[model samples]
Target: MTRVVIVGGGPGGYEAALVAAQLGAEVCVVDRDGLGGSAVLTDCVPSKTLVATAEVINQVRESGELGVRIGRSAPDSGDVSDVSTDIAKVNARVKALAHNQSEDVGRALQREGVRVVRGSGRMAGPDRVAVTLADGGTEELAADVVLLATGARPRILPDAEPDGERILTWDQVYELDELPERLVVVGSGVTGAEFAGAYNALGSDVVLVSSRDRVLPTEDADAATVIEDVFTRRGMTVLSRSRAERVERRGDGVVVTLTDGRVVEGTHCLLAVGSIPNTADLGLETAGVATDERGFIEVDKVSRTTARGVYAAGDCTGVLMLASVAAMQGRIAMAHALGDAVSPLDLEEVAATVFTAPEIATVGWSQHDLDSGRVQAVGIKLPLTRNPRAKMQGIHDGFIKLMCRPGTGIVVGGVVVAPHASELIHPVSVAVSCRLTVDQLAHAFTVYPSLSGSIAEAARRLHVRGQQAPRKDS
Candidate 1:
């Protein structure tokens, strides 16, 4: 039996440990932090839980605009500000849910018969790991393969480090006992936009700083436009094309200075400047493993590092920096290490979602295809307002877009932007994964008055793109 040792109990490590154990391998997972790793305990789960409360608040705030009577619109017609919010209860629930999820992950791993070591683990050699136990004792273990699933940490600017009080990282934001009076989110990426939208909905006067022309610049252009439009409509002060240079505490609050010499004051500031791979102090060089200049481990499709019998997965590999990608990399590593038929990782089929008000989800090739000329495909876009379900939900923005080969009619890629777009994008993912034809997708049944119908309609338009021939060669 091949012995497998996985470092870091994040989704990648835990999921791979379970797979290795099922394969009849002796699996041991060592992690300094609680089970479920950062994805569950601190970053993704906690943030999403907080966002859930924000979503509720957003819905309630919109009910008035929808003409839905909610206890008779506040007494003050001109001012109209009677809806009060309690942050203490919302924050407590968020932390409790995050803790419960972390515990559940630990319980499941234990039930799988995989040893869960709570400690910081470092490589002693290519195939040996030394665990510094929580109580300070050290334990050495040997394995046929070592999987590095250690996740990434938030990147802080040199001039503006998070003091965890006035300035905060994504993880530290969960510890807040009460909401800030004015929250300034510094970054326009997924994390930045998510927190900006969430806090704004949660009743904080929000100011979003974007170095780029629009928020979520890396996402689909149309989708980004929709989100930015909503942000402005909801009274969010969006400072586009402005990069934050420094953050300093002023009096009881903080002031963020942009490169252009303008300052924005806020009760609290959030640095959403992305993350760096966790590869320090791992003794990776001692084991003959190679890492990039940025310290991310270099691995192939099979998760094999430069050193034999050594593998790396998750954010450490810097493949996609997504938990889902990390989990897949770990499983592929175990399967290949244990003599099972393994397929190389194909990132093209990977689906990514941005959790905004109307979530944006995309899979396979993007609009970059049109610019690069890699694929000759026709694109079709349909607005959500055209859908009956969207009308019922009072959603006027967002759309479903599809791209297909003009000649072959095969669905190449697609993007969905709407409520639960993450879930609605699954069919598009299936089509892309299976390389389904446009006709096949158009034939698929989508319930009427549903968001998914828009996807099918987009496909149908592609199928009939050139159906109308030139009018008598005029």
Candidate 2:
């Protein structure tokens, strides 16, 4: 039986350990943090939970616009103080959920009989890992195969690095005992935009700093435009194409300096700049694992590194840098390493979601690809406001865009910008993965008066346009 030693208990590492152990390999996982990594313990789970509360605030705030106002009698001075945000309670719940998720992952691994070691792990060789245990002891584990799934950490700008207090990383936001009076989210990528929208809904005065033409520039152009418009309309101060040069804490607030000599001051600042792959200090060079210029491990579709018997996945490999992709890569590595059936990962077919207010979920065919003639595709967009369900839900913004091959009508990909778009993107992902045509997707039944019906309608329009007659007939 082959012995597999997996480093880092994030989605990539833990998932691979499970798959390897179940495949009859003796698997051991070395993790520095609690199991479940940042995705479960801090990043995805905690952020979403906070967004849930923010969503509640949004709904309550929007009720007045919906003509469903809950009148409050003239509040006495005492009642006003009692109605403040119970941030301590919210933090408690967030921490509890993070801990619970970590516990569940740990228990599942134990039940699966995978050896779980709490430690910092570094590769000793192509087939060996050296782990420094939590209690300050060290152990070397030999393996026939080694999986590296160490995840990434927030990319801190040299001038505005987080002090873990007034300036915070995404992971450290949950520790706040009170919400900020004003929040300046620097960097208008998915993370920055999402947090800005969430905190704005939670009643914080939010300012979004984007060094781009619009928010979510890497996402669908139309989707990004809608988000930017909505953010501006909702009182968010958006500074586009402006870079933050430094962040300093002032008395009871923080000040962010822009490269353009302008300054943005807020009660707190969140550096949502980006993340760097956690590839340093893991002794990868000794093991012959090749990393890219940016320190991201270079791995093949089957998650194999240049070093024989050594593999890397997840944020470490820089494969989409998503939890779902990370998990899939891990499983792929296990199957390939343990001599099981393995399928090479197709990045184009992977579904991705940004957890913003009206979440943006997409699969493939970026707008830049279409604009640059790299992809020969026809696109159709249908607004969510036109959908009956969206109307019923009182959602005024967002749209669904579908792209398909011009000749064959095969669906290339789609983008959904709406509430719960994350869940709604799965069907589109299935269509893209299976190479289903627009006609096939159009014929697929969707619930009436549903936001998803807009997707089908968009596909139908593509189908109709594809079948249009020649101008000579006109």
Candidate 3:
């Protein structure tokens, strides 16, 4: 049997191990961290669990609009102080959920008959891996194929290092004993925006510091505008176009200094600057694998590194850097290496979601792409305010946007901004993947008074035979 050794037990590594084993290959996975990497243990899963709790808290806070009451102190009476949560328990639950998922992944791999080594892995060569065992010695595994899936860690500024007390990284936040009284999040990207909205909803006096004109600068413009509006309306202080110079602890609180000679104080600080791939000293040179200047592995669509028998996937490959993308890349890497039918990674068909309040989910081309003449397509947007379910849920923000080819009318891309936009965007993803026309998408069945109905409505509005003419933006 072909021997496959996967380094790093992340979504990329573990998923590749499963496929390799199913293909009747001898597969071994070297895991330094837990089985699911940070995605399960720290990053995506834990953060989303926290976001889920934040959403629940936000719901209780908004129950006043629906004439809901908790005890004698009703929410409609503006008794904000009555709304509180056991944050320590919530965080504990978040960590526990992550832990359970990691355990589940490990069990799945075991069921697949994949050998798992608990250690740090290094590429000894194009066809070998050297694993440093946790307890004592090193074990070198000879392999016909080697897969590198080492993930990334949160980036911290030199001057704003995390003490794990007053300052924290996204991963370390789950360790907090209580919700920060005031949280100053520095960075307005997806990670920053999600956490900012989460903490704000969790009752922290949140101050978002962004070095851009607006939050989620890389997302859909109208979507970002809506998020920023909601943030401010919910009493979040957003300092836009301001860069954080340094973060320092003062007594029980922390202080953030901006380059523009301004300072902000908060109970805690979160550094959402960015991420650095965990590729340093991985013996990539010895293995004949090539990496870019930033140390991300240079891989083809089939996930092959420069080395002959070596492949790389996940954050290390720098392909979108999402957990789902990482898992897909892993499957492709194993498929190509094991001589199975393979399809190359396509960013256009990938769906991405940002877990902020009134979450933003997008797939394929964006509005910027349309406006900048990158692609020719007609688009239409329908607000969720008109949706019966949204009205029942008291959702006033968010919209559904659908885009299609001007002539062929094939659905090319879509964006859904709503509570559970993640769920609403799947059908749109299917349409984009299948190259379905707007008419076909509109004619699909969606339950009445559902948020998904807005997706169909948006597609119908963009339909060639529809009464409404093709418009640019909503």
Could you estimate the TM-score for every candidate? 0.96, 0.94, 0.98
Candidates in order: C-alpha RMSD to true structure: 3.0, 3.8, 1.5
lDDT of 2: 0.86
Report the number of clashing residue pairs per model: 0, 0, 0
Best by TM-score: 3
In what order do the candidates fall by lDDT, top score first? 3, 1, 2
State the lDDT of candidate 1 residue by residue for 1-474, as single tens digits: 788999999988998898898888999999888888899988888888888888777777676556554555653332223355678888788889988998898888888899989899999999899999998899998989999999999999887889888899988987787889999999999999999999998889999999999999998888899999999998899999999999998777999999999999999999999899889999898889999988999999999999999999999888898889989999999999988889899887899998888899999888777558987776878888889989888787789888877677777888898988889999999999999988899998989878898888877777755643111100
lDDT of 2 by residue, 131-238 (tens): 999989899999899999999999999988687779988998888888889999998998898899988877788999999989998888887888888788778999
**How displaced is residue 182 in candidate 3, in Å?**
1.0
Q: Which stretches of model 3 miss by more than 4 angstroms?
A: 72-81, 466-469
Predicted candidate 3 versus true structure: per-residue lDDT over 292-338, tens digit per residue: 99889999999999999899989987879899999999999999999
- How far residue 143's Cα lies from its native spot in candidate 1, in Å, is 0.8
Q: Rate residue 232 of model 1 by lDDT.
A: 95
The TM-score obtained by model 1 is 0.96
